[model samples]
Target: LDQIILNLVSNARDAIEDNGRIDIKVSTGSSEDILEHNSIVKPNADKYCLLTVSDNGSGIDEEKLDKIFEPFFTTKSAGTGTGLGLATIYGIVKQNNGYIFCESKKGRGTTFYIYFPESDEKPSEKQLIGKETKPDEQVSSTDKKILLCEDDEGVRNVLSKMLGAAGFNIIEAADGEEGLRKFKENKDDIFCVVSDYVIPFKNGIELYEDITSMSPDMGFILVSGYSHDVDNIAELNENRNFSFLKKPLKPELLKRTIMDIAKHGND
Candidate 1:
């Protein structure tokens, strides 16, 4: 939700040439009310929440509305945006058993509606923990094999070489389907699966499920350009001890995540 809000705000800021209006409305309701009003299923039956962010700026063209959520589909200039923000948000919302809808008109405005399942449990407050600054120089000798799944050829090659140079044998897969095949074939030899969240055929989460079902101890790291709802990722991380690395990834962050998982074995 934080990421989604940030992306919307940033996009709105970019769209506005001088001054514009951004309206943020948050509401809580029951499944029945949501269904009655919105004509959409409440993400969860017991309770539900709705968050809407609307921006009065340069709106999207009608033609691009359907493609906005497609991965790598962006209207922004190269290097300005990854085009992954909306897609990532869609994936995150879907993963969390939620639904997202966007309404926009060229020159009019844009609005995004996000519906989340609710619970009686209180929301947990989180404390900010600064990143570890002290580096652990202890080199790992674990000859663990990793399944590297990435759609981008350049990213895949770079990560494969880096992991290989780190004394870890890597099985490279171009997309999610191939990754799943390789993982199933080398289930015993594979120690972990590092995958891009957006891939051809299937996605990282789908692959994670397939691999983990076969090898209960199998580890996963999801690399993506952006995210919509980090809470969904947090829930997964807490439950499965999986890790996520945001894109435009730094080599250091990747190495740290790998080393942490390799050393502690997901706690």
Candidate 2:
């Protein structure tokens, strides 16, 4: 929710000229209201927390509205926007069983209405991330060390926390080269190599190939943020020693997967 709100606020800010105002309001609503307000043609569930962001800025046009949710669609000048902001936000909201609606006119202003379903049940791993550990994942095993290779420091820190909480011992590196070096230095100790698909010095496949040459049955997991990079959720490897996870890595899947390595062995 924080992420979605921030992106919307940022968009609102970008839309504004001079000192235009942006308003954010959160209120409870029923599904009937969602339909009546045209916030959603038909919301799937009953209760909702409606988020409305309004900007008194240069409003979007009717022609552009249809394409706003499309990936890489932007009205801002080149270098001012990446065009992935709304697309990513749309993905996140819909994935969590929510709805998004927009109201705009060329000269007036633009407002976005987001309807997030309210649930008493705890969020699933696919919903809100970083829920409590699974029953089986509660057991800690420090011996199952992981070579975590990610270029971004912020992502690495967050992932390190999740890995530690999930009970795996960590060996970190900034990029594929450093990751390979760490893997070599601790070859015997490192049971699994979890690497970012795109990184400096060497790519993930190259790193995997290099390590696998030395340790053919090395447990490997290729991690990537882009959805297109991983086509074979089919299986990370035919031998069951390889796997993959998309980023903004969810806690439960990460724990379950790393633990799978321990239970199944390096193979």
Candidate 3:
């Protein structure tokens, strides 16, 4: 569920080259009103749950919309991006017994409507993301500083709030390049780095490689919404001063990871 949100938001961010608005709205309706021109959405849904992400970015051309969900079929420049974002979103929604539809015009921006069959079963709290309803019960905080690198503004805000409430000072970066710069500037003071695996300019691996070369004992945590990032880290063949977490972080889980790394730094 978190991966779905991250991919859609990231795609929207990439679409807008300049200032634009992205609106996320949720509504519910009967299957009849929402399902049209698609035979797949008819049988499985009685009522539908709609999560729409609308963006005022450079919209897709009619010719390209059909191929948008195809894996590795990106229109981005070479060495810039992957078509995997949309393809992953499509697969996740479908696996949850849902469907995704896109509406767009060349210059009018785009909206993606995701329909999920409303389910009565709520995931147990153990499976929930950002599980901080019991904040007082969370791991204690420290005075150390943490470097947070993520390109998405909304996600960065939420994470900052969570970590700040836990009593740590956060040094922020919008992308991998800025993150590396800050690391160099504050190398002597920072206790650890918590960064997204798929960041712009330079990826988490590059940042990790460069930083660990300079401060081999500095604690590092690499995160991403993509599972294959795990495979990438595995290729490194050594895991020291390093750990990883999948995206849509649970609050207590993140707090524990950070505390552990900070403790290691103290040692």
lDDT of 1 by residue, 1-267 (tens): 656775676677666656788899999856665565468453356566888889888899889888999988998878667887788789888998877778888887888888788766764454245343454545453568889998766557767877788788989999889999988788877767898888889888888778878877777898876665243786777745488888756666787677777766624
Tens digits of lDDT, candidate 3, 1-267: 656776677677778867788899999955775557365545476887888998988898899989999988776668556667788789888788888889898777899988888887888877676444564444444657889998868778878888898899899999999999999999888888988888899988888888999998888988876667566667553665688877555556777888777766555
Estimated TM-score for each candidate: 0.49, 0.61, 0.72
Candidate 2: tens digits of C-alpha lDDT, residues 1-267: 656765687778777888888899999878987787674376788999888999998899899998998988998888556578788889998998888878899877899988898877976776666556677645447777889888866567767877887668999999888998898899998888888888899988789889999998888888866647755546545657888776545556776787787777732
Q: In candidate 1, how many clashes are counted?
A: 1
Clashes of 3: 0
Taken over the whole model, the C-alpha lDDT of each candidate is: 0.77, 0.80, 0.79
Candidate 2, residue 116: lDDT: 90
Worst 10 residues of 3 by lDDT: 131-140
Per-residue error at 15 for model 3, in Å? 2.4
Evaluate model 3: give its lDDT.
Answer: 0.79
State candidate 3's TM-score.
Answer: 0.72
